[model samples]
Every structure is written in structure tokens, then in C-alpha cells.
Target: MAVIPVALAGRSYEVRVGSGLLADVAGQCGKLLRKQRVPIVTDSNVAGLWRDTVATSLEAAGKEPRWLVLDPGEGAKSWRVLERVMDWLLDEEVERGDHILALGGGVIGDLTGFAASIMKRGCGFVQLPTTLLAQVDSSVGGKTAINTSAGKNLVGAFHQPGLVLADLATLDTLPVRETRAGYAEVIKYGILGDRAFFDWCETEGPKVMAGDKAAQDYAVTESVKAKARIVAEDERETTGARALLNLGHTFGHALEAETGFSDRLLHGEGVALGMVLAARYSARRGYISEADGERVVAAIGASGLPISIAALGMDADGRKLANHMLHDKKMDSGTLPFVLLRGVGEAFLDKQVALDDIAHFLDEQLKTA
Candidate 1:
């Protein structure tokens, strides 16, 4: 087991990555499980797979497990479901000192964390991230949010988890498509800052997706370590340091909105394609050579993730897609700062990005093969 600390002053926590953490859920959580009745929020899919393991673990520890299983999907991260979760927690008589367990993918973690953040003016929560995307990215970061009609993750808060148990065993049940999508975020850590890690990914990415345990462990642990370092430096995204983490998110969120945030494009899929766009756009702006932009596209494409917006089969044009970014949460004083690449491992924030120029460039991209 690899235990990486998210050093956040008084609220620091550990993100443990390994196999069978879920089997020892009670022992892993330790003192965080303070009450006899432990409140756990998860999606029905996750409950079907690992509920018994968690239940048995807590039960063996003399704790009664209380389960609130939600419908699984992006739709669950909404105002309506949040109200339901909040009401359920209320019925459980949860107090501010109580730690709620979020036992699923990013959706469960985000919604449960958001609920805990506002519950009695901030309670504690632990993240049992089941999916690769959640374990590597969302679970460690304190950014919890629900998607509003205006945009994805429009309603949320920065509520850090007390503990994060990323059990690698859970990845065994993930579909190949989901695993490939999750690889997008895995590669993202490399693309944003570490050229060495990016090189490592270029060769070993296939091994990670193939479910090789050693590869999976290295990928998850390294990604978490990078996130922990960045997040510790800028907890609330007040500094531009945290914004680097959004390397592909701005463009990715726009693609998500254009697709109605449905199964047509998973979040990680959008991010994979978004990074390609960011790289290509960076080349257009002369920040990087065309060959380097193609390098980014090739690496993402080799992993079987979508590398082009043209392939999405959307009826929308560049103007429509660019317009969707208008509601982006990152928009400041009518200018949206973009995370563009200076080189493979050099990402910088460009606040001078114009939506109009983006529309024109996207129009060109839309017409391509």
C-alpha cells in the first residue's frame, strides 16, 4: 500500500492506494468511523459489486453500516439528488463530527463530499474511490461539485475528505472502455508538469490499461502524489498553480455541454480529446511545434481515447461549441484563461484567449478528418 499525504495544514489527510483496502474498510478508516451507525453513500452499481465486503468489514468492527444507494451516473450529481442525500443524512441523525463514507466513483465522491461540506456547516467524509478516474484525480482533490443546467460542476465546494482509500482491486471490474477513459486523467498528470512521467506513460500506458497490477499501482500512486503536491500548495484554487490541473478541463467541459453531458462522452473521454485540442491550439499559437502537438494527439489516440472533436458526430459547429464555454466557471471579467502547452511538459495559463478566435479555430478543426 502506498500512503500519500495531502499536506493541507490543519486538514491534511492521507490517500492510500493499494489492493484490498475495501475489504479492511473499517480498519483502514480507523478513528474516522466514530459511531455505531456508519453512514455510507454509494451508487447502486458499486453497491452491487462491493457492498458485502464493506458491510462485513464494518460489522466485524462492531459497527452497524447504514447504506444509501443512489442511481449511478452523471445525472446523480444534481440539485434534486443532493436534496435526497441531504435528507437521508438528516434522518440518520448525522452530526458535524461524523464522517460519512463516499463509496463509489467520482459522482458519489463529489455529491457526498458536497453534502458533507454543507451539512451542519461542514462535517467530515472519507472517499472510497472505486473507479480509476476518481482514484487518480477527483478523490484526492477537495473540489466537490454538482452539475447545474448552466454547466458541469457549476454548483459545488472545496470540502476535503478525511481519508481516501483507493483500492486497486476495484479496477478489475471496470469495463475496458471505462478503464481507457480513466487513463486520460492518468496521462494528464504527465502532460501538465512531468516530462519524465509523460515519457513513462507513452510506453507503459498499455500495460496499465491491460490491468497489470504493478503498472496500475505506479500510475495511481504517481498521479495521486502529483495532485497531493499541487493541491497542498493551493487548496482552494486561489493560486494559478492549481489551475494547471485544469489543463484540459476548460475545453473538456465545453465539449461535455455540447454533448448534453451524457453517455455520448464520458468526462475522461472529453478530457482526452480536450488535451489534444489544447495541444493543437498551442501549436497554432506557435507555443509549440506542430510535431509536438501531434505527439500529444498520438499518445492519447494510442490509448484508444478520442483525439478529435470531428469524430463525436455532433451536429453542432465550432461557434456552438465555443459558445458553450461562455458559462464556464473559470470565466473571469469576461475573459476565460486557457491552460495551453508551451511544450510536452510545460503548461501555462493564457488569460488573453479570445472566444472568437477559438470559434474560428474550432471551425477549422470541425472540417478536418
Candidate 2:
């Protein structure tokens, strides 16, 4: 097991990533939870795979397990769902100091954390991220929210968890597509700022995908370390340091939103395609060579991720896509800030991009398609 600390002063937490860690979850989380009435909040699907083991572990540790099973999937991350969870917690007489145990993927963590943070003003929680996407990214960052009509994560808070337990065993149950989609996040750490790490990913990522334990541990450890360093430097995204983490998020979010944030486009697929587009755009502006853009495409393609707009059957002109971008939450001073790459391992946010110029470039890109 490898433990990486996400340093945020009083609200700091440790992310533990390893295979077979679920059996030890209660022992690991005992520090943050009470001996009695520890609520295990998971969606119905995860409840089947893990609830018993988690309950047994907590019971062995002297904590009685109380469960609040939610319906699985992204649709569960809504105000209506949260209201039901809050009502259940209240009926169970959960206290301010008690914690809600988030035991699923990003959807569960985001929804549960948002509820814990707002219920009775504030409460503690633990994260047991069961998917690779959650393990290497969402579970540790403390960015919690439910989707809104405006956009993804439009209504959320920075409520950090007490701890995160990422059990690799859970990943074994993931469909290959889900595993491939999660790898985009693993690649994000490399693209954001580490050339050497990017090289490592190219070398070892296949084994990680093949279920090699050591490779999985290394990837999760390194990704968590990169995110922790950035979060410690800019915990609330006040500085552009934290903003750098949104490397492909601008275009990705726009695509996800345009798809009505449906299963038709998973966030990671959008991010993979977004990263490729950013590199292509950067190459267009002469920041990076076109050859470098090709490399980005190849990398994402090797991971079985989407690397082009056409892959989504998106024949829409760039103007149509740009309009979707205008609704992006990253807008500042009435202009959207895009995270563009100068090259691999290098990214910078641009706020001065002209919408008409973007439309023109995208229009040109449409012809090549």
C-alpha cells in the first residue's frame, strides 16, 4: 500500500491505494469514524460488491455499520437524491461529528461529500473510491458537487474527506471500457507537468491496464503525488497552479455538456479528446509542433481513448462547439479560459482567445475532418 498525503492544513487527508485494501478499510478509517453508527453510503450496485466486507471490517473494529444505499450512476448525483440521503441520515439520528462513508466511484463520492459538507452545516466523511477514475483523481481533491442544468459541477463545494481508501480489487470488476476511460486521468498527471512521468506512462501503462499490481500501485501513487503537490500549493484554485490541473477540462466539459452530460460521452473520453484538441490547437497557433500533436493523439489512442471530434460522430462546425464552450464554468471577465498545451508536460491557461478566431480555427478543422 502507498499513502499520499493531500496537504490542506486542518482538512488534509491521506489517500491509500492498493490491492485488497477493502478488507482493512475499517481499521484504516477508524481514526476518523466513531465506534458506533458509522454510515456506509454507497449506491446499490457497489453495495453488492462491497457492503458485506466493509460491514464486517467495521464490525471487527467495533464500529456498527449503518448503510444508506443509493441508486447507482451519474443520475444519482442530484439535489433530489441528496435530499433523500439527508432525510435518511436525519432519521437515523446521525450527528454532526458522525461521518458518511462514500463507497463508490466519483458519483458516490461527489454526491456523498456534498451531502456531508452541507448536512447540519458540516460533517466529516471518508472516501472509498471503487473505480480507477475516482482513485487517481476525484476522491482526493475535495471538489464535490452535483450536476446542474448550467453545467457539470456547477453547484459544489471544496469539502475534503477525512481519508480515502482505493481498493484495486474493485477495479477488476470494471468493464475494459471503464478501465480505459479511467486511464485518461492517469495520463493527465503526466501531461500537466512531468515529462519523465509521461515517459514512464508510455512504458508501464499497458501492464497497469493488464492488472499488474505493482504497475497499478505505481500509477496511482505517482498520480496522487502530482495532484497533492499542486493542491498543497493552491488548495482552493486561487492561484493558477491548481487551475493547471484542468488541462483538457475546458473542451472536455463543453463536450460533456453538449452531450447533455449523458453516458454517450464519459468525462474521461471527453478529456482524452479535449487533450488531443488542445494540442492540435496549440500546434495551430505555433506553440507546439504538429508532430507533437500527433504524439498526443497516439498516446490517447493507444489507451483506447477517443482522440478526435469525429470519433464522437460530431460533425458540428467549431462555431457550434464554441457556443457550448461559452457556457463553461471557467469563464472569467466574460471570456472563457482554455487550458492549452505548448507541448507534452506543458500547459498554460489562455484567457485572451477570441471566440471568432476559435470559431475560424475550428471551422478550418472541420474541413480536414
Candidate 3:
């Protein structure tokens, strides 16, 4: 197992990446298991695939595993389901000293982490992320929240997990579409900061997605390391350092809102398309060469992700898309900050971007796409 430390002073934790980590979770988490029972929250889809392995592992360690399976999808991140999870955790009598295990993708990790953040004023929790997206991005970061009518992740907290088990073996069970969606995030790391990593992905990304264990481990580990450094420097996003992680998120979240946060467009797919938009917009502003913009799109498309807004089949214009972006969390003093690329591997936050310009640019893109 490769261990990456998230050094956050008192709230620090380790993200463990490798195969069979789930089956050996009890051993790794034994020190943090203050109580005989650990409460696990997961979704329906992951329940069938991993419930047994987790339960049997805890059982062997003499720890009682109590689980609550929720309905799968983005809908599970609503207020109603959050209340249900709270009630279940309360009924389980989980204490501050005891840790709750979130075993699934981003939805489960976000919901469970938020629940633990507020339960009894604040309790400990563990992240056993199953999906590729969760393992690389959402699982490591302490940003946890539920979607409200206002916007996505508008209501959430920054509660770090006690430990994160990112078993690469779980990716073997994920569908091709979901795996490709996660690769978008992996590429985002390179686009935002590291030119060499982006070059590496150009060659090894296909192999990583093809179930090459070594390639997948390197990708996940490198991605996690990048996140750990940023998080440790800016835990609460006070400094602009951590915002670089949102390379394609501003445009991506707007696209997600326009799509009704439905399965019609996965979060990573929106992000993949959003990165293309960010790149092109950067090129339009003369921040990067047109060739670099096309390079970004080519990498995303090669991974089988969407590179244009037209592919989503949405009847949206630039004005409509910009309106959705008004709800973005990155808005500062009524001005929305956009993560635009200077070139491949060089993303910077631009706080002075005019929304009107974004609408016009997106309008051009929609027509061309």
C-alpha cells in the first residue's frame, strides 16, 4: 500500500492507495475503532459489491459493522436523505470517539462526512471511497456537503476524515463510463499544475483506464499527492492556492445545474466538457495558444469524455449557461472567479472576468459545437 499524508496539524490523516485495502480495512483502521461497532453508510449500488467484504473484515477484527444503505445517485445528497442518515446514526448511538465509515462514491462520502461533521457537534469518520472519482478527488479533500435548492454544495462543511482507504481494486467493478468520468479529474491535476504529469497522462491514461494496476496506482497516488500538498497549505480555501483544484469546476458546475443535476450528464462529464470550454476561453483571451487549447480537448476526448456542449443535447445558450454560473460558490463580492488556463498545466483564477463575455464566448461555442 502507498501512503500519502494530509498534514493538517491536529486534523491530519493518511490516504491509503492499493488493492485489497478494503478487505484489510479492519487492520488499518483498528487503531481508530474506539468502539466495538463502526457505522457504515453506503448507497444501494455499492452495497451489493462491497458490503460483505467490509463486514467480514470488521467481523474478523471483532468489530461489529452496522450499515445503512441508501438509494443511489445525486438525489441521495438531498436534505431528506441527510435527515434519514442522521436519524440512523443517532439510533446507532455513534459517539465522538467512534468513527463512521463512508463506503461508496462522492455522494456517499459527501453526505456521510457532512453527517459526521454535525453529529453530536462533531464526530470522527473514515472514507472508503469505491468509485474512481471519489478515490482521486472527493475522497481526499475535506470538502463535504449536500445539495440545496440554491446550488450544488452550497451547504456543506470542511470536516477531514480520520483515514481514507482508496482501494484501486474497486475500480475493477466500475462501469466504463464511470471510470472515464473519473479520469477527467485525474487529468485536471495535470492541467492545473504539472506539465510533466499532463505529458504522462497523454501516454498512460488509456492503460490506466484499461485496468493496468501499476498505471492506475501511479495516477491515483500522484493525484492524491497533489491534493494533499494544496489542502495542507490552504485547508479552508482561504488562500487561492487550493482553488486551483477547481480548474474546470466553475464551468462544470454551471453545466451540471443546467442539466438538473441528473444522470443525463455526470459531474465528471460536465467537468470534462468544462475543461474544454475553459481552455478555449483562455485561448480567446490570448492567455494560451490555440494549439494548447486544442491539446487539452484532445486529451479529454481520447479518454472517451465529452469535449463539446452539443454532445449533452441541452438547449442552452451562453446567457443561459452564465446564469447558472451565478450560483457558483466561487463568487466573491458578486464577481464570479473563473479558473482559466494560461496554457496546458497552467491554470490561474481570474476574478475580473465579465459574465457577459462568458455568455458571448459560450454562445459562440454552442453554435460551433
Candidate 4:
């Protein structure tokens, strides 16, 4: 087992990564596990896969377990679902001292954490992230939210969890596509500030997706470690260091909105393609060489991620897509800051980018896409 700490002073917590941590959730959270029953909020898909093992573990540890299974998907991150979860937690009589377990992927984790944050002003909760996306990124950070009609994560909080249990074994049940989607976040770590790691991923990513245990462990650990360091330095993103994590997110979130936030394009896939756009745009602006931009495109394409918006059958033009970003959470004072690359392993935030220029560049891109 490897434990990576997110040092947030009074809000510090540990992200535990291992093969079978889920089966020992109760043991790991001994003191947090009270005589009262623990309430776990999950999605239908995940409930069928690992609920029994989790409940069995808590039961053996002399803790009672209560389950609330939700419908799975991006839609679940809405006001309606959030209300449902809040009502359920209140009905369960969860207290500020009780640990509400978020026992699924990012959707469940985000929803549960948001609920716990507002329940009686604030409460304790644990994150048991099942999907690779959740384990590597969402579960570790304190960013919790429900999607708003205006944009993704527009309605959320900065509530950190008490602990995070990331069991690689649970990924065995993931569909090949979901596994590949999660790999995109792993790739972001390299694109943001680690060229050597990027090279390593270029060679080892396929194997990791193919279920190579060692490779999977290495990827998750390295990604979490990178995030932990950044979060420690700039916990609330006031220093701009934490904003570097949004490498492909600005463009990616626009794609997500254009697609109506459906399965037509997964978050990570949009990110994979968004990274390509960022690289290309960076080269266009003379911040990086075209060769370097192509290198990023080649790496992402080889990983089986989308390289072109045209291929995805998106009908929205660059102007329309750029309009969507107007509501991005990263926008400040009517100026949208973009995480653009200076080269591989180097990214900077540019708040001076004109939306019109971006639309024109994207229009040219669409011609060949």
C-alpha cells in the first residue's frame, strides 16, 4: 500500500492506493467508524459491482452499513439528484461527526461530498473512488460539485474529504472505454509539468489500460503525488499554481457542453482532444514549435483518444463552441484564462486570449478536422 498525503494544514488527508483497499475500508477508518450505521451513497452501476464487499467488510468490523444507490451518468450531477441525496442523508440522521462514505466514481464522490459539506453547515465524509478517473484526480482534490445548467461544476464547494481509499482492483470491472477515458487525466500530469513522465506514459499507457497491474499502480501513484504537491502549495488556487491542473479542461469543458454533456463525449476524451487543440493553438501563437504540438497529438491519438472534433461529429462551429466557454468556472472578470503550453512539460495561464481569435483558430482547425 502507498499513502500519499495532501498537506492542507488543518484539512490534511491521505490518499491510500493499493490493490484491495476497498475490502478493508472499515479497518482503515476504525475510529471514524462509529457504533451507528455508516451511510454510503453510490450509483446503480457501482452498487452492483462492489457494494457487497464493502458492506461485508464494514459488517465484519462490527459496523452497520446503509446504502443509497443513484442513477449513473453526467445527468446525475444535477439539482434534482443533489436534493435527493441531501434528503436521504437527513433521513439517515447523519451527523457532523459521522463519516458519510462516497462509495463510487466521481459522480458519487462529488455529489456525496457536496451533501456532506452542506449538511448541518459541515460534516465528515470518506471517499472510496472506484473508477480510475476518480482515484487519480477527483477523489484527491477537495473540489466537490454538482453540474449546473450553465456549465460543469458551476455549483460546487471546496470541501475536502477525511480520507480517500483507491483500490486498483475495482478497476477490473470498468469497460475498456472507461479505462481509456481515465487514462487521459493521467496524461494531463505529463502534459502540465513532467516530460519524462509523458515519455514513460507514451510507452506504458497501453499496457496499463490492458490491465498491467504494476503499470496501473505506478500511474495512479505518480498522478496523485503530482496533484498532492500542487494542492499543498496552492490549496485554494489563489497562487495560480493549482490552475495549471486545468491544462486541457477549458477547451474540453466547452466540448462537453456542446455535446449536451452526454456519453457522446466523456470528460477525459474531451480533454484528450482538448490537449491537442491547446498544443496546436500554442504552436500557432509561437509559444511552442509545431513539431512539439504534433508530438502531443501523436501521443494522444496512439492512446486511442479523439484527435479531431470533426471526427466526433460535433456540429457546433468554433464560434459557438467558444461561446460555451464564456460560462467556464475559470473565467475571471470577463477574461477567460487558458492553460496553454509553452512546450512539453511547461504550461502557463494566459488571461489575455481573445475569444474571437480562439474562434478563428478553431474555425481553421475545423476545416481540416
TM per candidate: 0.99, 0.96, 0.99, 0.99
Winning model by lDDT: 1
lDDT of 1: 0.95
Candidate 2 lDDT by residue in tens digits, 1-369: 888988888877888888778888777876677747788789888899898889888888888888888888778888798889889888878778887899998999999999888888888888999888899889978889998777788788999888888898998888777787788999988887997888888888887778887888888889989998998999888888888889888778878876778788987888887787788888888888899778877888888788767656665777887887776767877988777878889988887788888778766665654
Q: What digit string (tens of lDDT, one per residue) describes model 1 on residues 227-289?
A: 999999988888899999998898899899988989899999999988999999999999999
- Expressed as tens digits, the lDDT of each residue in 130-184 for candidate 3 is 9889999999979999998878998899999999999998999999999999999
lDDT of 4 by residue, 147-250 (tens): 99899999888999999999999989999888888999998999889999999999999987899989999999999999999999998888999999998899
* Residue 130 shift from truth in candidate 3, angstroms: 0.5
* TM-score, cand. 1: 0.99
Candidate 2 regions exceeding 4 Å error are: 364-369
Off-target runs (Cα >4 Å) in candidate 4 are none
User: What residue runs in model 3 are displaced by over 4 Å at the alpha carbon?
Assistant: none
lDDT on C-alpha atoms for all candidate structures: 0.95, 0.84, 0.92, 0.91
RMSD in angstroms between candidate 2 and the native structure over all alpha carbons: 1.6
* Candidate 3 TM-score, true structure as reference: 0.99
**Comparing 1 and 2 by lDDT, which wins?**
1
Clashes of each: 0, 0, 0, 0
Off by over 4 Å in 1: none
**Residue 155 in candidate 2, Cα distance off native in Å:** 0.1
